[model samples]
Target: MNYLTVLGLSAATLTTISFLPQMVKTWQTKSAKDVSYIMLITFILGVSLWLLYGILRQDIAIVLANAITLVFNLTILWLKIKYGKTRPRKYL
Candidate 1:
């Protein structure tokens, strides 16, 4: 592997694995109230695009990284929607 490729893979590995902690935490707690729906939605969209780009360009690093990120982010998004509850009006 070339130096540039190694560097890119390293970065991709780190960022992709970094989501593990959050995924495990959310899985265990089954709560994602602190997570932002807009952020997750946009992130999923961006990752999906990146995955497509990687496929078109035949970039393994980008494809692998975005694939993992997409799965993690999707799980979190699903959990957030599943656990989130409707809020009632509160008059103070």
Candidate 2:
């Protein structure tokens, strides 16, 4: 692979993996009040667009990263909808 491809993959990996911590935290705490609904929704939309763009261009790294990001973003969105109204724990 070329240097640019390697760089793209590395960036994709980092950005995609960054969502994992937030996902796990929301999952474990069962609280998403701190997570902004608007932000999550906007992010999901952006990521979905990126996925479509990747599909159009047949870019593997973009497709893979956005696909995974969509999943995480959707999960967070769901959690926000489900638990956004409740008061979350102070410590978590």
Candidate 3:
């Protein structure tokens, strides 16, 4: 593999793995009150777009990273929706 490919794959790996801790924490705690619904929604949308972009570009690294990240983002979104109502809202 070329240096650019290696770099892309490495970046993809790190960014994808970064979501794991948050997912595990939300799963264990069963509390996604602090996770913003808007943020999750926006992120999921962005990831989806990135996945499409990657597919168009035929970039394995981008496709794999965004695809996996989308799964994680969706999972967190589900958790947030499931647990969101139980928590009190913050009004500023």
Candidate 4:
């Protein structure tokens, strides 16, 4: 791969991986009240747009990165909705 491609992929990998901790925490604790609905929604929208842009540009790096990030964010959003009640579900 070219330098630019490597750079893009590396950046994408790091950014995407950053969400793992939050995802795992939400999954285990079943609590997402601290998470903002607006933030997540807005980010999702932005990422969706970026993904579309990437697809249009035919940039594999942009497409792949945004696609994976989209999934991560979506899953987090789903968990936020599912476990966003007043009290966190106890972890066993």
How far off is residue 38 in model 3, in Å? 0.8
Candidate 4 lDDT over residue span 1-92, tens digit each: 89999999899889888888988998988888788999999999999999999999998889998998899999999999888755764657
Of the candidates numbered 1 and 2, which has the greater TM-score value? 2
Which lDDT value does model 1 have at 74? 95
Q: Which ten residues in a row have the lowest lDDT in candidate 3?
A: 83-92
Worst 10 residues of 2 by lDDT: 83-92
Ranking by TM-score: 4, 3, 2, 1
lDDT of each: 0.88, 0.89, 0.92, 0.90
lDDT of 2 by residue, 25-73 (tens): 9988888777887788888999999999999999888999999999998
- For model 4, which pairs clash? none
Alpha-carbon error at 92 in model 2, in Å? Answer: 14
Tens-digit per-residue lDDT, 1-92, candidate 1 = 89878998999999999888988887677677788999999999999999999999999999999999999999989878877864333458
Residue 61 in candidate 1, Cα distance off native in Å:
0.3
Cα displacement (angstroms), candidate 1, residue 10, comes to 0.4
**TM-score for model 2?**
0.88
Runs in model 4 lying further than 4 Å from the true structure:
90-92
> Which TM-score value belongs to model 1?
0.87
The lowest-lDDT stretch of 10 consecutive residues in candidate 4 is 83-92
lDDT of 1: 0.88
Models 1 onward score TM values of 0.87, 0.88, 0.90, 0.92
